[model samples]
Target: MIWQGRSRRKPTGGLYRPHRKKRKYEMGRPQTETLIGERKIKLERVRGGNYKVKLVRDKYANVYVPSEGKVVRVEIKRVVENPAHVHYARRNVITKGAIIETEIGLARVTNRPSQEGLINAVLIEQK
Candidate 1:
């Protein structure tokens, strides 16, 4: 498992001795690469008594249109551009700041779908 704790190195490039062993709470999981497909989600129990809804795959998005002043549910056609990674666009991995092709038009993802379990985007250019 990946560790989410602080690094062992200091800002001055000095190595620091271990103060204590790693705890389970400090562990991390793999990244959720959300893709366009049939809806799929995972429920994860996080710290505190809460749960995290991880989105694995989805095909629709709630696109907000400024001209209409309302949100509309639209089908995602494909990934256009992903600022997070160059290959993400080709792989169709959805992430925040990614431009996607939807039934309404081109839209920019405004939220982290993998973390929010939903895709929210703002209409950019109309079809």
Candidate 2:
């Protein structure tokens, strides 16, 4: 389990004794790594009785073409660039701001696939 609580050490390099135990409200969850593959989705529960849609794996993306002013669904050919991590592109991990190759052309992902359930990208190059 991840703790989102206060630090154990002070800024002056002094140890801070815990006054109380951990609480459920100060908790964190693991990260979801969305990958390129067959369509797969997972629903997760969040704080305040809410639900979040997570895209576990996917092969297609909704690409918005500025020239046409419309969105099109196209097959994701591969991950080209990922600013989050260099290895993410090589492993085909889809993330926001990632440049991906699509059937229509190259696109830059605009939405968070892990949190949005679907990939949305803006067209950067036309084929």
Best by TM-score: 1
By TM-score, how accurate is candidate 1? 0.89
Q: How high is the CA lDDT of each candidate model?
A: 0.94, 0.92
lDDT of 1 by residue, 99-122 (tens): 999998899999999999999999
Instruction: Give candidate 2's total backbone clashes.
Output: 0
Per-residue lDDT tens digits for candidate 2, residues 1-127, read 4557778899999999999987887776777899998999999988898999999999999999998899999999899999998899999999899999999889999999999899999999644
Show how many residue pairs clash in every candidate, following the order shown.
0, 0
Model 2 deviation from native, Cα RMSD in Å: 2.5
Instruction: List candidate 2 stretches off by more than 4 Å.
Output: 1-3
